[model samples]
Target: MSEARAARPWLALLAGAGYGLFYLYAIGDVTLYGPPHWGAYLTEVSLERIFTARSTLMFEAIAVIELGWVVWLFSPLNLFLALILAGLLAANMHGVLYIRAHPKQCQVGGNKAFIGALPALFAGGACCAPSLILLLGIPGLGAFGALFGWLLPISIVVLGINRIWQHGHGAPSMLEYARQRFGLNNPSTA
Candidate 1:
């Protein structure tokens, strides 16, 4: 496999861990905070509106999805699946990074796999933070949300970009290097 392809599993694991940590931190922050001061910000918006049963359900869904993602990413039996997941994640990372670097690239599916995963990422964040903030009346949940929701995604995207840069900067190309070193084919093409 190409070097990039060979490294897919590790990359996937790293990406999964990154996202997992982000979620964990966000969840922890909300659980600790209590609830958001929406009333302080808006006269019309009540805590009940923010923390509806539907919102709680949404949070549960996010928790399930994130937990599933973490399990799949770390499961040894799911290496191939992890690789596939990594590819999608890499695409999303690329998309986020691209959008950051070039604001004009935010169109849906503009980055294909990357953009495809945006909804999941956003949903994950929303489910984790907004729901908690609504229900608990937390103080820093918004800040936490902004940090993980925005910075973490951007960081992951930058990580992917850096990997691409490092892989492409040398002579033989990452694929050739991986093929020679690990007998791995270029799965990116596959």
Candidate 2:
């Protein structure tokens, strides 16, 4: 894989973690319980009237109103969260395609970094903190979501760098590097 493609997953994961931090702080408490409250800044005469206007198009109304609502709230946290989520979804899609393309390779390491993202994302959520603490039986763990947030990305980054280095030193690629690193280099019996 090209360096850019190799780096894409790591970059997306880190970006998601950063946006998760934003979600944990400024906007998380207020942004998600329901639709944003209508603002006088958006409506022509009144907030309710703007939403009730006859000019609102069926197909475009949701998009326009949502955008207006976010802008009316005047916080970029939602946009940051949205973009980060899009990046993560794209990365996971790429990983899925990679797995489909490389059937001969062992499945264990192929998309593990991608898989690690699920828990990493869970730790990002405010509500998941308690579950993580409960499951691990650590009292203060819930308060460290931000720290746990970077763990997956950082581990992926280290592994990616190691793979790139291995490839540079004449190992074939990350798959080959993983096989060797994990002593899975034996020929496949299948």
Candidate 3:
């Protein structure tokens, strides 16, 4: 393969490995903190009811799905995974936004990953709001929770659109230092 072609696979592998590390870290944090037990969110409900083993199992299953997507980032299937991953990222963002909105409720320490993962958690929440509503029995909370659940996706979509507008138009131009650091320029050209 040409050098550029060869580099693609290695770059993909690095991206996958990075995502996997991020996933593991996020799951570990959630397990350690037991899912943000403050406010009127579904997380609070889950904690209040002491989510059944089945519910916990389902949650773990979702985490595994996310991990799979992260791993797939190394493969040619990354394009497909990127869309879903973006939604997950958005959900994380939503979580962060929630925490920011309710500063008194956040229990996160100074962990950099925790700070970074907040936005992702929010984005993930937005992406999965419908499922969350169904699983949590949204109707039981009457109109308020139902309205919140219904609005979640719209918010996420808007956030995504804004992000795309802000960052999607540019093509990368490598600086000499960046080319050296990432080994990204064409060897023959150099």
Candidate 4:
């Protein structure tokens, strides 16, 4: 296998983790505060609060965890949602890497994988902040504000569909690609 193919899983995992951190940061669950060397431990640990939202709004944080340089408001629902988004993003990125590594084996374009990631990036900032809707200052937009809550879900659906579409189109195993590239034709077929 090519080095890139061998490292595909690791690359996707790294990408997913990075995206998750960004997602948390965007949603205000995680924040950068204090000196770099500072750190703290988890606080307000409660099982009852796990399922309960502090407010009536969706995606409310349940617990506060402080690691001095970074503070995280732990919310299971939001974390799960972030994981789903991150997984989908990782899958799409994996596809892009595969396409780049094995161009001849794929019928679909590589850019679709990248295009599929756009929705998640766009929606990440709006997860907990509906400031965009308020900034519009348009009358009768109160109802529209609810859409911001669905941004992550909508992104999930889009990425899911894009993944299905891409996979349904064409993908070849790395072993097969390597065999073809190296002209290691099967003797049985020959």
Off by over 4 Å in 2: 1-30, 34-36, 40-74, 105-190
Error of 3 at 128 (Å): 0.8
List lDDT for all candidates, in order: 0.40, 0.41, 0.37, 0.63
Arrange candidates by TM-score, descending.
Answer: 4, 2, 1, 3
Error of 2 at 30 (Å): 6.2
Best model per TM-score:
4
- Candidate 3 local lDDT, 1-190, one digit each (tens): 4434422433434544454344333323222333333332122233423332222221222111223113211221222333444443443333333333333334432243245554534554453444455667867544443454334345345545533322222212223223754677767796
lDDT of 3 at 66: 24
- Write one digit per residue (lDDT tens) for candidate 4, span 59-163: 566667777688888888778877877877677666567765555566545565456546654554455455444566667777766566667667677767665
The reply for model 1, stretches above 4 Å from the true place, is 1-9, 29-110, 131-190
Error of 2 at 31 (Å): 3.0
Model 1: per-residue Cα lDDT over 23-60, one tens digit each: 44443422223232222112234445433332222111
Output the lDDT of residue 179, model 3.
71
Q: Which has the higher TM-score value, candidate number 2 or candidate number 3?
A: 2
| 1-190 per-residue lDDT for model 2 (tens digits) | 6534543445545655555444433332223334555443332344444344221110111222333334223223334444544344334433433443443452434455346445434433433343346667986665675555454344344434433432333334434434544568557742
Superposition error at 159 for model 2 (Å): 10
**Candidate 3 wrongly placed segments (more than 4 Å):** 1-110, 141-181, 186-190
Which order, best to worst by lDDT? 4, 2, 1, 3
What TM-score does each of the candidates earn? 0.29, 0.32, 0.28, 0.67
